[model samples]
Target chain A: MFLNETQEEVRNTTRNFVNAVIRPAAEALDREERFPSEIYEEMGKLGLFGIAVPEDLGGPGFDTLTYAVVMEELSRGYASIADQCGLVELISTLLVRHGTPEQQKMLPDVMSMKRKVAYCITEPEAGTDVSGIRTTAVKDGDGWVLNGGKIWIHNAPVADTGFVLARTDKEAGNRGMSIFIVDLHAKGVERGPKEHKMGQRASQVGALGFSEVRLGPNALLGEMNRGFHMMMSVLDKGRVGIAALAVGIGQAGLEAAVDYAGTRKQFGKQISEFQGVQWLLADMAKDIEAARLLVYSAAMKIDRGLDATRSCSMAKCFAGDMAVARTADAVQVFGGSGYIRGFEVERLYRDAKITQIYEGTNQIQRMIIARELLRKGATS
Target chain B: MKILVPVKRVVDYNVRVRVRPDGSGVDLNHVKMSMNPFDEIALEEAVRLREKGIATEIVAVSIGVPQAKDTLRTALAMGADRAILVKSGDDVSQDLEPLSVARILAKVVATEKPELVIAGKQAIDNDMNATGQMLAALLGWGQGTFASAVRIDEGSALVTREIDGGLQTIRLKLPAVVTTDLRLNEPRYVALPAIMKAKKKPLEELALADLGVDTRPHLTVVSATEPRQRQAGVKIQSVDELLSKLKNEAGVI
Candidate 1:
């Protein structure tokens, strides 16, 4: 409601699309444990893949706030669908920001809504601490050699290509790491079985393995030993997207709670009229608003080319906690029905937990916040 | 072929809309405006032709307040070679159709003699959906609306439009007007260098009177008012009560 007319129209349009297309399919995908590849394909067809891509790369040439709006609507549809959309956003952002001119030339496929890309940074051991990743990227003649592994990667089994993080220098701490654009068909590259996850089950999370994966000089993203910095910088922007996603997930929970509270009975009274339940609903609404504002503020900062790392961390930390708490509260509002597998609130409860864990755990975000505050204190 | 794509300044389509007090129009004060979505489609289609090695030159043009240059720069970022802005003040409540805009555009079209023109179907602000068709009629050119896809071939081009029910294909002669929809093509973000280059792009300025067109509103705002407010529905106690209300009072069932 705080948005302008065009944004409202876009929200309505996206919501309508979700109501018509995603809602009907949500239960079945979870029921069957099937990845929502078709949904991602549809989103790509709608040009969802290039929301962050630049105009020269065949994107719609929108701003960072535009991305926040799109991500919110998408996540509201199905967390996995929106999560897949986020992977594409992250990859396209990195490619545009750091890829070589020749690499830049290949972005039309990504922005034209013709290709799928996975982001392979998280492995089994390196979800939060990025410097702990074991994936290795070594330079050979003019080309580089990558012989490492990644796990929990979005769309690895189905992705045609991906932005992969690999270690280049064993002793260089964050500076020794590097990112590469790995074609799925390249030599020594293999995909493991799709991961079975508790929530966002429809998202294709899997492992990618490398055994002397060959890459041309063009495969290097950013500078050698700059991959960790590049990844962290990009992840800062990504935190905004994840925050938007969390808020959207919270929104879905709030809507479910509101709808049920109006009708669900308790001791011959509507649950909504019960003060205890009403307070929970009120708390959910307030939390959603706060998280949304935090996310939006960070997005605005990113748009202005300001250092938004602290804001991003704050938003991610706050929204991630809000998503989990509100979703669980939504389950409480549903009473016994919320415990069932098929209910939207229950799914949201499960889906909300990961937001706190990924893109830097809320704990890591706190550390980042404390670090920034102390740094500010020292400077001032 | 030289082509001119006229874009518009509008609120970013992802934001919610609120009607202004006095009921005359939408409140635009402090609102985040963006390049009209449909205009983006038009710009993308034209720029694609440039990328395909078919277009001789692609120029974006807009007729709005001086700040409208920002929208034109977006087109330049998307690969439009140059731009021109006709000064139309910030307080814009005029008929936003192609006829009023075509008067200004006709001057540029006549001067530039571009073989094609593209624009969005309509700005979401008012939802008139008239500009491109009206421009085609005024300029004596053919028009294609709700264009989902466009393909260029030699002197002519083929356009695929997503209609209300299904799809339709139309082959149009060159130098025509086309309006874009969401499915037309993904518009690209202009890169940093392109943004810098867009700042240097030749964005000429013209006065509304200089084009000999009277920029007057044919439709007047009779009055402005807020939408009606409805009472919140009373909560139901049980599924039985819910069913009873749906079947009886609400009569939804």
Candidate 2:
């Protein structure tokens, strides 16, 4: 809520670009299920990717709140566009925090969108339970040979670099894992067909197969055996990013509902004049504002180096549910017209469900919240 | 060639402006302000010239309250080499008319000694369309207003102006004023990194007194009011009735 002048300027600049570029292409991009590479390149040039990265690392060095604000604004125009940025942020932040000096050197290219990176943690066997992952990285003559598969990997098809989580010691459970910076173009790295999603299709998602993919010792990210912890830290920020994105989707839905209600007439009067419609709009606005506060609070805590796990889960769960509900209401506001393909709210309705499922499902978020609450006891 | 581009801070064009209840002026409290859209066009044109290697340096100047520094920062982010903010203080009552702005800019031009001056045709907030012409008059330089296209060559600029009749081309000697029209190349989006770098760019602030210029309003604004809302029209039943309404009520017969 208390955005600094630089943060506000970032918001204005992103909003201007969204209005001038993203918004116009949103519908077409969704319809075609194609990623808008040109828009992404433009955003990369604008330093959207560097919002939360450090200035020394070639980032704009904005705080987490600024990142959230940018994500929210971009998501309002198109969720996939924001998600693409989120993926880049997650990788960059992870590298900055846990990567070795050589690995961190990739920060500039990632920030500049010269190279795109995908986080490969979610596997077919491991979604919520990352410990169940079967991906393995075996040591072989000073290098590691990785043989595993990752599914639901966002940016995989287009990514030039990948931060992969593979088991270095299969017996150590989660501690056995290590993150590797894999050159996606290298030998034995295969990409599956892009998954056709229900919404947010502007982002490419696919499965990645690594068959004896050889990696030099320098490819190890952060430290060996600490990949799980590093990933947990990344997930904390990822949840906040997802929450901010949910807020954007919800905000867009609320706007669409409000606009449609005011214009669409039913029974000789505007639907906005009807008490039922008014109540729906009021509820959506209230929920969106509450969810935004939670999201921003978690982001601020992260920025201040405070523990944000519980708050991040709460924000993610609540905002995700709120977005799904609000988008449904937005479609309802359009009535039969919203059921059509060309309607923006209809697309938003389709896009809202994934927020609940990704970056740990809403169920997983609630479990985390409950576990934290049980462990720490609720603060008064 | 050094280019001087003057920008203005006005209420964001997307915002719905409302007149103050007391008739003082537009209600600007808590309202979002941005670079005047036309001024963005002017800045874009200047940046394009520099990009083409025609202009060596671009100095962006803005005359407004301290907040105008933000507008200048935006200009700098859009690729202006440096910026100068002529602070007008917090008094909204100050005229800040085209002539006063032009005179202030005239002093800036003398000190900066730019070979070319580019400005927006008009600030959207006032739509006066006079600053460029006035600045050229004070500088005793050739002027081109409503410039849709500008090409610089051999100590002169060829500018295509959008006029009532059609597009008109004029060649102005070096050190002349060219006002941007809507069609003058689309402004590039200022990336976030550029904005961060812009903060480090030189942005010098000066007061009107620093420029040794008089700042006073030449015109008085009467009670500002919203336009009357038009009523919904009714369908005509017959030609005779339509004729009767046109002749008697509308008086457009």
Candidate 3:
């Protein structure tokens, strides 16, 4: 109801693709824990990646709201797939906003999935605290020598390129950091084995090690030592994406629960007729709708050039918490069957947990929200 | 060759339509509307022909409220070169009869002069499968109905029609009307980039009066009602009980 005609059209197209292609394959993808290259290839052709990148850069040039809508629909099919889209969006946004024309030449390949990318931020030492990162890129003549170890890096096992965040100056603190575009296949670069996870198993997560990896003069992205601020600039949009993903997981759960309730019989009648089950379904519906509205509001604020930090944090935090709680309700509605391995609710419940942890943990979101309130005043 | 595909915006097939309590018609308030499935298949066939380089251009035409433009935009996104929207009415509940639609289409035919016209066999909303036949009759051209496959040759067109018990092959001259059936083709997904590009494509709008066709309903709906819900069935315990229930209660034994 909050969407415009174009947005509605986009949602319908995305949902159709998701329902037909992604949803059916999600179970197998999770079961096998292998990347679905075929699906990503098709999604690339459909312009599902780098949504905010301009048309001149071989992308759809859509706004934040459209990207949010796409993210929710994709996550509804499979959150791993949506996570991939989100990663591309963040990387592409960095390129569009900061990269030189020569570096930006990779936009088409990135959007088309020809060049798989990794955003290397989380480290063994730095998970939530950015200042603790020890990865450093020491300047040497026209180039730099990079030495670092990053863990829990998405796409690290298969990515062709890496946007590595490292300290260029030891004494500069946050301003000491710089983002360099590193070639994954370069010498001294190593990829750790993929990590098995409870959910979104299809996404290949591993550790990347750079042992004195050599870089050319063109490796640096934007101004040196501005990487932290540049990363912060995109965090609002990132939260919106993750928030939408959480909402999608909740929405998928609600649909499964409602359908199951209507068909599964108990006491010689459909479970949907019972008030207990009805309340579960009702709560799932309202909360999912609420989270969805919040996501849209945050997306619209970003698109309108307003300060969206608080809205983004609120959306991310509430939606993530809501997804976990409601998917649990969906599992309850499914009874014993919900706990089964193949049941969608079980997977969705597992999938909903990461939303609270990644893209700034729900706790971190709360901190940011309170920080915004205290800095700008609650009424602002 | 220039192909004309006539599409319709109907109540989404997934929706459970409810008849108005006053028996006027189906209640359309806040109902989801989408391009008719058969019409989408028809457009798909036309797009396939263009993709095969057999057709040069495709013009999708729809007769309905202004919102039908959304469906036309979908048609464009699916590969139609252009679209024409004939605004027949402002009310979403009132659907133009097949005859009026055919007359308007004939007017469009005389003006656009397409070599072929592909339309849906029937609109799911009314099941009035007469538009294609009526249009062909009005234009004095051969017609193919329930087409499962279509192929254009030098001049004539080969159409495989799904008959009552089997398939019938018919040859129709150029400038003929072919109605799509379920097995014709599956429509392709409208890609995001294509949708963006479709916004720039031409979509000309015309009022119903501009076509000089009378759209007044030729028939009146006396009443409309919902189908009766099936009664719950009893579960028989044993074979003897099943036979007894069938013989005594159902009386079908």
Residues A1-380 of candidate 3 have per-residue lDDT tens digits of 78888888899899989999999999999999989899999999899999989888878789999999999999999999999999999999999999999999999899889999999999988999988899999989899999989999999999999999999989999998999999999998999999999999999999999999999999999999999999999999999999999999999999999999999999999999999999999999999999999999999999999999999999999999999999999999999999999999999999999999998999999999999999999895
Question: Individual DockQ of the candidates?
Answer: 0.05, 0.68, 0.72
- TM per candidate comes to 0.64, 0.93, 0.95
Candidate No. with top DockQ: 3
Q: What's chain A's TM-score in each predicted model?
A: 0.94, 0.98, 0.99
Evaluate fnat for each of the predicted models and list the values in order.
0.00, 0.73, 0.67
Interface RMSD per candidate (angstroms): 10.0, 1.0, 0.8
Those runs of model 3 whose alpha carbons end farther than 4 Å from true positions after fitting are: B230-253
Candidate 2 lDDT by residue in tens digits, A1-380 = 47877787889999999888887899999999897878877787788885778778888888888889999999999999999989888888888887777878878888777898889998888988999999999999988999999998999889999899999997898789999999999999999999999999889999999998999979998889889989987788889999999999999989889988998988999989999999899999999999999998999999999999999999999999999999998888889998999899999999999999999999999999999999999981
Using DockQ as the yardstick, the better of models 1 and 3 is 3
Best by lDDT: 3
lDDT of 3 by residue, B1-253 (tens): 9999999999988788999989999999999889999999999999899889999999999998999999999999888999999998899988889889999999999999999999999999999899999999999999999999999998999999999999999999998999999999888888888888899999999999877897787799999988899987777789999888889988997
